[model samples]
Target: MFNLENLFGKSTRGRRLKSADRVSGALPFITAGETDQGISAFIGNDVKVFSANTTTIDMFGSAKYRNFKYGGDDHIAVVHTNKLPKYASVFVTSAIHKSSYNGQFNYGRNFYAKDADALDISLPVKDGKPDYEIMETIISAIHKLVIKDVVLYVEKKKKELNKLTENANAVKC
Candidate 1:
């Protein structure tokens, strides 16, 4: 186990952006909400743009993986996972979520960058170092399984729909 700051890199808090000042555009504006990966809106305002392959922890302690550049509000803490590979970063994001999103942080006690810095999480280690290779492999295998499940579900749904259509046609004949 290691502290989040040491495991990844520097952690920072985002600046505040009011909804009234937001202008619609292409840049994602991250907030404290869990829906849509915490994206409140897309805006053209010139806010500090965080890099890709990072993780954002909301004030409520919900962590989400970000694979695209985005701007965030003060209610979000940005974890610098850009140095790690995408799959490794994803693994770290999950670790962060499991460690932090426990209903401890709330409106009265919001999560922040300092909290993220102090957060401890367990990772796959090899020779006293995080095993990025293992993290990557694990995420890749999980991705394949998810895709396989989706494909099977689609096939089953298609067969059911075809049967319904055939029965309806026979009844109409």
Candidate 2:
């Protein structure tokens, strides 16, 4: 297990923006929520984190995987290191979920930077160290499975639609 401080460069709070300021703006102004992307609104470009592979853990224990360049209110934001792979970035978010202090955040306690820095995250061990390659492979496998299922479901729905159209044509004849 490694402390978050080593993995992430430093913790920084996101720019505070109220709901009124969340008009049709440019940047993705994110706040704490259940969403994976954590894009609550699109506001100004004041102090943004353009890094794609970053993780933003909210006060409510919601950890979002930032696949795109965005800005957010930092409850406990962590920028990915140069050595950290994209899949490992995802793994970090998942590991953040399994934190022992996560339960406390449920009762209105925020996941602040100080506590997050101390919290240890379990990793796939190889040679008694974090194995990033294993995490990537597992994610890749799951991605393939999910894509396959989605394709099959779409094909089935298309076939059903085609059958309905054929039935309608026959009725009109």
Candidate 3:
């Protein structure tokens, strides 16, 4: 049987379960005009740990929202829990807010339990046991790098779009 104590490095109930209490600084943001999609750095509902494998990579929200029949109405909203566990992935490259500007940043995964579970999580074992922290760090770094690259790409594209628009306006003038 898989025990939380062995996997999480802690045995307390709080450490093993996601408390019902609301997390501070966790504001809900909506994604619209698209299918329900989201990415979460946490795997289980207990505590959201920031890691590539642990993160949710699945589509979520109402299916109707994704279709244009409803005038492309309805949006998917993501709630960011501030109290992410210490083991949570720390994105040193770019904060979530900075990278997710205008929803251009893509985590390359759908934020959903089913999809998250489908990920191939390889835990690095040194002697005979897998190193949880090491694995978490590695995944976090991957996510950070990916998000950073995305941000840069989006910024570049936006600049190009702006330049073209400006040139077009200038031509008209």
Candidate 4:
């Protein structure tokens, strides 16, 4: 069975679809759509520049929905390994906004890609090669553990809150 998550790494998974190609050195040009017909026209014209418009490179089940937004446009593109060449790297654009301090943006990780640009995360690398299978297993295990812990903690907190509410009501009476 094909694992969709495995195909798109967490770093490269959620990225906005822009009409820019690193090879061609082109940037995605944003245009306003007046109506549904105009939107269709934009897509039809962009299909040649972006493979997502015409070719279904990574049009796998559920993968189509697992993409990030580029700018304000909702046009999502499914990232696929096949479309990228051996030298290209996946670019992750993270916009972090916090109200505690002045609103500032920070990219947690800088442009992590698979090729030379790939970040040196604590992923299993044997003989200087990424052991993807081991990394995937580890990630999956940690994810499950975190979910279980969160659920248990929430349930415990709920019971405690209910007891406190009952005590407050009794005191008021």
> Candidate 2, residues 19-55: lDDT per residue as tens digits?
7755566777777767645677776646666577777
- TM-scores of the candidates are 0.97, 0.85, 0.34, 0.35
Model 1 TM-score relative to the real fold? 0.97
How much does candidate 4 score in TM-score? Answer: 0.35
Model 4 / residue 136 / CA error / Å: 0.9
RMSD of 2: 2.4
- Candidate 1: which stretches are off by over 4 Å? none
Backbone atom clashes (below 3 Å) for every candidate: 0, 1, 9, 0
Q: For candidate 4, lDDT tens digit of each residue in 15-89?
A: 333555222323332222323211222222222332231111111111111122122133222234333222111
C-alpha RMSD by candidate, in order: 0.9, 2.4, 13.8, 13.4
Task: State candidate 2's TM-score.
Answer: 0.85
Question: What lDDT would each prediction earn against the true structure?
Answer: 0.94, 0.71, 0.33, 0.31
- Report the lDDT of model 2 for residue 40: 79
Per-residue C-alpha lDDT of model 1 across residues 1-173, encoded as one tens digit per residue: 98998876769977998999998999999999868878999999999999999999999999999999999999999999999999999999999999999999999999999999999998999999989999999999999999999999999999999999999999999
Top-scoring candidate (TM-score):
1
Best candidate, lDDT-wise? 1
Which rank order by lDDT, best down to worst?
Answer: 1, 2, 3, 4
